[model samples]
Target: MFLPEAWGRGYATEACTAVLDWFAGALPGEPVVLYTQSANTSSMRLSAKLGFTELERFEAWGAEQWFGVWSPLTLSG
Candidate 1:
């Protein structure tokens, strides 16, 4: 979902949350992983908002990459 015009409108966050929620339900006890460039602040913020915790950081493709994980238990409490 790449929409420059839709940036900062909360659309990405909302859509991602809905998708993650549905996926959690469809596959209980499974974890979801996301990788994004560390320089992308918006993505980092969204990942945190979606209950993703940083698993590691590494240099990749000539840039820093952030690896995160999310799980139903972590999000639900």
Candidate 2:
């Protein structure tokens, strides 16, 4: 997560990319899942950029939630 003051600076994207790369190297065939509020557009964009595909959307905690999954195989094409 990034501070509101740090929004739009690409920090989230960079950090997430690094983490995902590490996960892919460490867990070849395993998948990674991410959950975020539907309203958080930045997170949605980041997930898409990192190759996450939406698995489901449901209401929880009074707000819509997004569930996505990513795998190294998917990224490798």
Candidate 3:
């Protein structure tokens, strides 16, 4: 996660892309997942760019709202 003050500088997107590359190269075919709160539209968009699909919303930690599951194809180079 990143501080809200750091939004729009492409840090999350860039880091996610890099991490995706490393993970795919290191563990080829392994599954990956990312979950973020519902209010985090930025993160939701980031996940979409990285090919993450919203799997389900559940109340696990806080006030009931989360996104989950990212496809392995998201790690494509």
Candidate 4:
């Protein structure tokens, strides 16, 4: 997790992209799941930028949670 001061920077995006790339290479055709609270717009946006597709929304911990899936097969050149 990034600190408040680290928000808005590309650190998270860059780091996540690298990790996803490695994951895809290490496990071809595997899918990953992402979970974030609906209140966190930044995370939601990041997930989208990372190519995660919305799976569903559910109430948890008294707040709406977002669930998304990311599959290496969905990656495009």
For all predictions, the C-alpha RMSD in Å is 2.5, 2.8, 3.6, 2.6
- After the best TM-score superposition of candidate 2, give how far the Cα of residue 48 lies from its true spot, in angstroms: 0.9
Candidates, ranked, lDDT: 4, 1, 2, 3
lDDT of 2: 0.91
Please name the candidate that would achieve the greatest TM-score relative to the true structure.
Answer: 4
Provide the clashing-pair count of each candidate structure.
0, 0, 0, 0
Model 3: lDDT to the true structure: 0.75
Error of 2 at 14 (Å): 1.3
Residue 11's lDDT in candidate 1: 87
lDDT of 2 by residue, 1-77 (tens): 67899888988788888998898899888999999999999889999988999999999999999999998887864
Q: Give the range of the ten consecutive residues with the poorest summed lDDT in model 1.
A: 1-10
Model 1 RMSD in Å is 2.5
Question: Per-residue alpha-carbon lDDT of model 4 for 1-77, expressed as tens digits?
Answer: 77999877899899999999999999999999999998999999999999999999999999999999999999895
lDDT of 3 by residue, 1-77 (tens): 77888878888788887887788778877878776787777877787787877788888677556666655565444
Top lDDT hit: 4
Q: Rank the candidates by TM-score, best first.
A: 4, 1, 2, 3
Model 3 TM-score is 0.72
